[model samples]
Target: MPFTVQYAVPMTCEDCTKSIKKALDNVEGVENVDFDLEKKLVTIRGESAPSQIVSAMRGIGRDAIVRGSGRPNSAAVCILENAQGKTRGLVRFIEDEEHQIIIDCTVAPTTPQAQQVSIHASGDMSQGAMSTGEKLYTLGMTSKFGDVFSLITRQSLPLMNTIGRSVVVGPPSGPTTESLAGVIARSAGLWENDKVVCSCTGMTLWEERKVATTV
Candidate 1:
């Protein structure tokens, strides 16, 4: 999905900005990157997934949050840890009674040690919807279908969203042009007249409805 990355990089001079651009520009899947020292922001327009961005930033000892006018799925709990088994931070995706997605990020001393992690968990409850508790169970119980931890996070670590009849169309599997259109539509909440102004990478067709409305 389209996202803006803001980080506290020490870009106090033009040379620093150029250096950042050089590093970020070389990252695979990154399209364009702009750094603003005054705002302490590094805004990036790209299809690169969050994990890729995070990995790149962390490699250079930088931190970033990707948000923007067009975001597709909500990323699930991110457990950043050190070799000492310390949990550096946790970001959770929760849904309330209203079916709206709530995202919470927390800093902790250590990452929770678990048998596994399932990124494809939901927090919202609705008709035919699953609960976060259920997701937790799946993460802990389901091991045959695939490795939940890797499967859910292999892409961009996704958190389950709504679970009702989708207003938009979706493909059976894999990524397609139609799939991208669907995600763009949902994220923007485009109606009959609304159209997708742009498309972002790492977004699924299911998210088109949300983006359509919110953007």
Candidate 2:
């Protein structure tokens, strides 16, 4: 199913937009692309993976940050981190209008082997994955590609119920203290987030992006 995903791109001229459109045209599964030059936002309607879209944008020497996806109140995100607070991966959940949940996950520096990914009952992360409660739902296993473990699958999990839970990635046996875990949080829907500056930090989008990428 086709869903909308929005990105914040730095564009200074119509030529930049043309470049982006031209690059995205080669990405499979992309249905359409729309741009807001003044806002430097690009909204894409497609079935393409978010990572693929970002890579496409980067192919033209432009960086893209995903601003929103899916529909209002139907999307959520989790940043899996180890006990040391080092980010290990990111997971995005999008429930389409048909109620089919799209799970997109990416983990780096993982062994070139399959590993279990699931949601736990508790969101507590004081002790990392070990502290998260019982496993509630097993999304699936991730397949390794190069140095990253990536998985893009469609399931039937409800988005709302997963909020406040914890998603964990670990060995096939089960989660451990060394496993990666993160609390699920609600994310903005397509076009729901349009602020150029973060009110809390008074930092521009690019500034925030700098901090995020550094981390």
Clashes of each: 21, 0
Q: What is the lDDT of residue 10 in candidate 1?
A: 41
* Candidate achieving the largest TM-score: 2
How many residue-pair clashes does candidate 2 contain? Answer: 0
lDDT of 2 at 40: 87
lDDT per residue (tens digit) for residues 1-215 in model 1: 44333333444678777767766766877887766676455656565554566456646654443332223343233332322333333333322222233332222212122223232233222211222223322222111211111111122222253321111111222212221110101121101112212255544221322232221
Q: Check candidate 2 and list the clashing pairs.
A: none
Tell me how far candidate 2 lies from the true structure as C-alpha RMSD in angstroms: 3.9
lDDT of 2 by residue, 118-162 (tens): 999999999999989899889888875434676666678888999
- Global lDDT of model 2: 0.79
TM-scores of the candidates are: 0.40, 0.73
Give the distance in Å from residue 38's predicted Cα in candidate 2 to where it truly belongs. 2.8
